[model samples]
Target: MAKTNLKTATAKQRIFRKAINLLNQIFFTWNNGNEEELVSFLQTIRDKSPNVQFQKLIASSVPFLNAFVQNQNSNLFSRIYRHPFIQGYSLPYEVGNTKLVHSDWLRSVLIRAVCYCSSVEDFNLERIYLELTCLTNGYSLRFVETHVQHFFNFFHLHPMRYSRDQIMYNKFRHNWFNYIKIQHELSDQLQQFDDKGQLIHLNYLYEYGAR
Candidate 1:
């Protein structure tokens, strides 16, 4: 990467980066084990910012916050994956289901909100960028899962919809699994697909399996 104006010419970026510099510290101390720290950060942002959508999300997640859990794309290092693909969000619910996968607006909100909770400026950029990139292309980096369940539950979604690997056979997949039937038309065709190719093919099956 070339040296850019952000490092030298932009005063706002410099100050903005300084304001978030606290994220580099990891002295996260808690008293009484009640998650008052996370709660406080959420409250601060919700109370200070005038954005209605941001306020709404914070309000929903703070009270009912759950212990972070890993989803399919997550490894031991990265506990959190990005929100579920927008293509499948509509299958079960109809509210707030925007095409947020590429929305800088939403990601920016999430970065600040999560960093507030974390109280650190240092973060795993590769994993965040992985989220911004479509997963089928594959990424070696991952992020510790955040309170995604808070967001999902805020929307009243069943955990199964987003927990892709939790379904261990017996048809624990999408809600439409029962409807998949092979017609005689394509049964006789001999198709060839390699291992990675199989996943690449799932893009065509977005409705049934979104990876």
Candidate 2:
């Protein structure tokens, strides 16, 4: 058997490694939760920057990203997994009541929003799926269910009218599901809590079952 040098490092490999290091230092450091630090860093990079699209991507995803970082427990790299900026958002509604799902238009918006956010960041897809299913604004579970139903309806009705890459934004008094989902899932994992601060579980909410 001959000894193989497959594991040996090369100049190109080193170059790529250094490039990634520089990219992270320049682009991903802002993902750190210190808002003030991030703002200051953004100001510094405002003029001479790399990939302006990255800026746009970060700008668009910031709100959800901030929410995930604020709520979750993890460092910058780990938090990117469930970066709320990449997981999308839902309408604030009550839980347990089925009436809210009636607005099909809104439900679809939520679905599209979640999809859009997930597409923006490089994160674990399974985590994103689970979080989007379980995440909400601390409103009612039943109301959230209704919102999901409404979101599905919107997606179904539109069918081919909208592009898969487009966010399901609403207007003209359609379904009220406005906020979009983020591009990544959170690392802390999603915990369901009721108004009384009791732990609860509602996996069935986003399951798109025989509807």
Candidate 3:
């Protein structure tokens, strides 16, 4: 009976390790624009039994998984500390500060939108922009719309209005809005492909900068 218990513990550890590695691969794909392999890997991880504790890993992996999944452009953990929505939503309200309210609405909205960006190619730059705009207090559709306009203007594309800028909305209705501007920006900024149009190093930039 003791041996069986030991084996069970060992199995859980293995699950934990693989889940951690999968999360790392997801992060690398997002930052480095390696979608094909990441999609395949994500599918494999998703196919694992729902009872395997993958969701639990995401919740418990702390600084690592949070950094891996959250705002990759910013230090993910740092944003959690200062973000207005998080500040509005975090627990342990001060006594007599009954004005405080904690709600998961903003986080849920952001996560669902991110999941819509399934591939590196499909991941739109506006998704990040809208997410940042939405995390602030009393964020209006106009606030998100302003960034959408700026994004398009930067690319010399026609700006989208608040109603047409759907990435700010919940995921189900946030379908493509003929917003080719975002796709162009992502393609232009893709790190793996160089100016001369060649595939660059997966890890070279990190090593080169470390020297």
Q: Estimate, for each residue in 17-104, the C-alpha lDDT of model 1 and write its tens digit.
A: 2112233211111222245644654355445443412222222122212112222232211122334443421212224522333233
The lDDT values for all models are: 0.29, 0.35, 0.36
lDDT of 2 at 54: 34
**1-211 per-residue lDDT for model 3 (tens digits):** 2223323433423221212233333222122224574355445444543323222233321443333233444333212213334543333334542222212333343433434443322234435544454544344565445544544454243332233334433222233323334665777777546766775655432111000
Rank all candidate structures by their lDDT, best first, as comma-separated numbers.
3, 2, 1
> Global lDDT for candidate 3?
0.36
Off by over 4 Å in 1: 1-101, 109-122, 125-211
Residue-level lDDT tens digits of model 2 in 1-211: 0001111312122111101222342223233346675465445444343333234234322323322222133322122323435545544345654334534434454443443333323222432443355444443455445554444455464332233432332231133223221212221234333444665665655534222
Candidate 1 residue 79 C-alpha distance from true site, Å: 8.4
Each model's number of backbone clashes? 9, 35, 0
Rank the models by TM-score, top first.
2, 3, 1
The TM-score measured for candidate 1 stands at 0.18
